[model samples]
Target: MLRELKILLLLIIVVGIIYWGVEPLAHSIMHPKVAPADYEFKDLDKIDLSKGDAQKGKKLVTENCTACHGIKAEKINPPMDNASSASSYGVVPPDLSNIAAVLDHNFLANFIKNPVKATELSHKFGDSNPYPMPGYDWMSDDEISDIVAYLASIASKNLSDKDVFTQACDRCHSIRYDKMVALTPDADLERYLGTKAPDLSMMIRSRGPKELSVFINNPQKMIPNTPMPRVGLTQQAEKQVISYLEKVGDSKKAQRDSLGIKIMIFFAVMALLAYAWKRKIWSDLH
Candidate 1:
């Protein structure tokens, strides 16, 4: 009886070690640079946003941005249609109705000043290959601040999960399962990101939540040479984006989890019954 008990203890230890090595230990080796997501905009400092004026910003956007981009919340439409814009710029400019609410404030300010540098894609664009969005460096600091304030004032605070994902990711990455294709053309995305972005339809299930969160927060941390820049989404916006991805990628997660529990209970009961039978059959020998 003591020998049988010792054998069982050995099996448990072996199983535990296998699980540890296969899961956590292997994961640490694979993703050695894993880090927590950072939502702060610490890159470049510009004009003070507190003193900005929305009305002045609205005038500035109309005068400067409406030709290419649109502000749907303010009923501002792009002058060109989708196909024409794509042909001209290699990507369709997205609506900026909620950018200020979702994107980091300082990042937004710096992005308006220099799109390539703020996006960390200057290496991708060069003197001959200029970035599509012209920098508004000539605009005064106060003017840029006003534009940021105007965008903030018009942005909806309570956007849906889909809206958050659309604003934050859909431009580069497409969710084919949801029938949402990328706004940027594949060739253009490749030129900008070094490779075309992957479809997020099954990314949540493929990469898992923990990995996805850290990657989205800051891509360069995990992939040192990847051209995918930090999106700088607000925490709430990042959560909403991940939630949307989960909804699309793992819609039946709850049902799968419930079924898994039932399977575990069945296996556990079978194991107990088999052990009892083994002991009963060996009783005569003992």
Candidate 2:
């Protein structure tokens, strides 16, 4: 009886492991999963901060963005200005008062054009249908840059480089700036662990430094049931993550190319499987 019980327990453990692995595989196979894509911010690195016209940008924002984003760029859904009642959607619009301080230009631009990629909180935090923000892909790159400049000018506080780096980057990643610089770009650090590491390229494209920083500080606050743990980070790490994101945003085109390669690889694997099945290649093994 004891031997039978032990065998049953072992079988259950094996079955559980197989089940867990199969779920993710099934999701990948059945769903037409849209892999995250990078956004190319044209010539953003070449932007001349000295030449930025914040006042002009502000005027343009008033004329165009105020209707949806708000006059002070504070409220959108519940109406920050009114505060009398929440919107029918029961979600308060995100306040943009400290947007420049809280988010990087790349993140801000992505949010304006594709709110889906702006913050993981959007997907993780609320219901499936949170208040929808309009996409402004029609806006010119210059106009977007100008708006960023204007926002930076009005923001109450700008995070110091150290503060940002410590709070954001160090929270989740085991990043050593000096060590990172010393390693060759192609070095596979995870080879020692016999497992592949998660690609950070997608992370940079999907989230800005500021949003990442805040999420690191308290993931539960943003998304109640998030699997991410809150790693207490100093402000410096947060700033570093923000700076890193800015640099990543400049290489957005390259990131997109990499994403395309991944998609091709996925299809290639699927094709190989189909060919093998057609040829009965696994008949003996099965």
Candidate 3:
């Protein structure tokens, strides 16, 4: 029994050491090889900004966007707590208020053209809508610009960071700022989103705007097998979301940084005093 017990202990230690030594390499090898990025802002540089008409955009918004989105705070999009919408899309559509501030015109225009192609996910996936956002490919360039303009006009200067969070990120992620932690469980997230979504609270601190923009534009290309779909937000919208994260995740960072200088000065003064006392005591001993 003693010999058997020793063998078991040795086996466990060996396994643990091997796992520790080989784990990182194993994970690297297992990681999916993402396809090269193909997603980009189509015709954004070529757009004639003079052609966009906000008034025309408003009319287009009424005809196309209002079905799943509402501009007012008092009104809710889709009019009911309908599971079918969530069943089809995996999340309820977000409100459009302040969208112009969060998303850039280029991404919004491309996304509006086609959500599926822009996000670059398999359209046949169970979570993706069977009849997704209709692409206005037939619309003239000016008309599409007008639609983007209308969406842009809805942004309000008075809107808070929380409002931006609600509009863009609340459906898939939940952050408990009061607790200073992320609340989503990996299992629940995988079930609902087909992969675990990271808590966004600290994301901006880790990833800057440029990298995030590419990731958000096409997640699959950035990290293969990642479950996050393209959010299809405009460039402005992405900025606002990042800004909001900075506020929530690193709200105290500025204050802490400022306080660090004072702390260092105090420590330096204390060290000098200690050195002086040590010299005085040694002088007496000598």
Candidate 4:
């Protein structure tokens, strides 16, 4: 027994040393040194959102965006299937149907101004892709805001949670809820999106809304090498999406939490009873 105890002690010491030795290295790797200026739109967190005119936004979308994006259930370009679209561009550009329902004004403005910078990939990798979406850096900030407002104005307020997620997130993300499955196969998905997207069923519970908001708004700000694109969702749409996530992932959190307290109390009572019974049984011996 003493020999076994010595071996166990040695094992624990080795493990403790290894953990302490690796901690600093892990921290350094996770928090790489990058100049503040290197970060794209680093000042966006401090920028104030400007209200936009949807009527003006509509004109801008027609003049600037109709080449790639479609609206009003009609294809501005020929209806190319997913394969064809993926072949042309690395990934298919999602439709803008009711986009205002998913994205907030702030996100729309930032993304529309410079999608590459918003995603932060181009800032780091220097635009390595063969087919890149050019940024509208020349468009005045007001014009971008107006475009966002236009999208928001036409957004369907009555859209279900699933519809919002499908339009906003389903293009890349996969949620393993009920019958909902991944849109792209693994082989094809990796070729375009760079990596297989993680399932978001338990995402809300794992990372709360605040964390999700920061990450969703600017993934690179939170995670240095994430493949997630900049999805400029409206504030209201973000809330709706969070609500849906809570329904799917943490629906029973309240009930489960309540039950947990009762269970702990029952265990405490049983423990006390067990101790009292032990005392009674040993009284005669004492």
Error of 4 at 74 (Å): 7.9
Tell me the lDDT of model 3 at 81. Answer: 45
TM-score, every prediction: 0.89, 0.36, 0.64, 0.70
Candidate 1 residue lDDT tens string, 82-189 = 667776886678789999988988788888988877777766677998878999999888899999999999999889999999988887889999999988878776
- Candidate lDDT scores, in order, read 0.84, 0.50, 0.65, 0.69
Point out the higher-scoring one by lDDT: 1 or 4: 1
Rank list by TM-score = 1, 4, 3, 2
Cα lDDT of model 4 by residue, 1-286, tens digit:
4776799899999888778877767866865643322223345432234667888988998888777666754335534665665566656667776776766556557767766665566643454563246778798777777888788778777988778777887666677874465554555667766778778899998888866766766677677777676666555656677778888888998899999999999999998899789778879788
What does candidate 2's lDDT look like per residue over 69-162, in tens digits?
A: 4434333332333222123222224344555665555656555654543443344334554424555668766776777778777765655554
Error of 3 at 91 (Å): 1.8
Candidate with the greatest lDDT versus the true structure:
1
Q: Over all chains combined, what TM-score does candidate 2 have?
A: 0.36
- Supply the global lDDT for candidate 2: 0.50
Worst 10 residues of 1 by lDDT: 38-47
Best prediction by TM-score: 1
In the range 162-195, model 3's lDDT, one tens digit per residue, is 6666666676676666333322344544565666
